[model samples]
Target: EAAVTQSPRNKVAVTGGKVTLSCNQTNNHNNMYWYRQDTGHGLRLIHYSYGAGSTEKGDIPDGYKASRPSQENFSLILELATPSQTSVYFCASGDTGGANSDYTFGSGTRLLVI
Candidate 1:
């Protein structure tokens, strides 16, 4: 079965720090994505990848970076974490590029910065 898994289901960080969110995708899905959900912003895409060795920045990539090492792995990194960056992050895998990308998501990682 194709599935996405994110680690450190919850996190807490100081004002200026670094946070690394890890994701693993199984089931040979060609497209994977990272999204953050916040109250006012709704849900915004942060990063995505087509396949192994390919990572692309999404709409709001200012404070984020992504890495795709293999067909089954992707990671989102916040080089300098801030309080405003605190939110629930999700990892998803799917068959993409069509009209609608059928995505299956991981539980989520909730991050809180102080």
Candidate 2:
């Protein structure tokens, strides 16, 4: 079975501090994405990777960094956390090659920046 797992399910960060949210997949998917869920706006893409050693800027990449060290692992990094960055972040792995994309998502990491 394919699965995506995220660590530190909940986190509290002080303003200006750094935070890293991690995700791992067992499905060996080549593409991964990081997104944040906010009130009224729905999910916004922060970053994504086509595969290992490649990272791409998504719709909302200003405050986020993404790393794909290997096919199974991807991480989202916040260099300077801020209150506005507080939201639930999700990591997903899948390919959008065609009409049906089989994406496996992590439960999510809830972040609160004060």
Off-target runs (Cα >4 Å) in candidate 1 are none
Best by TM-score: 2
Local error of candidate 1 at residue 76 (angstroms)? 0.3
Q: For residues 3-59, what per-residue lDDT tens digits would candidate 2 score against the true structure?
A: 999988999999999999999999878899999999899989999998999999999
For each candidate in turn, the TM-score is 0.93, 0.96
Which segments of model 2 are wrong by more than 4 Å?
none
Q: What is candidate 1's lDDT per residue for 5-114, written digit by digit as tens? A: 89989999887799999999886888889999998887799999999999898889899999999999989999899999989999999886686678989989999999
Clashes of each: 0, 0
Query: Candidate 1: deviation at residue 109, Å?
Result: 0.2
lDDT, candidates in the order shown:
0.91, 0.93
Span of 10 residues, lowest total lDDT, candidate 2: 95-104
- Residue 65, candidate 1: Cα error in Å is 0.4
Which residue pairs of candidate 1 clash? none
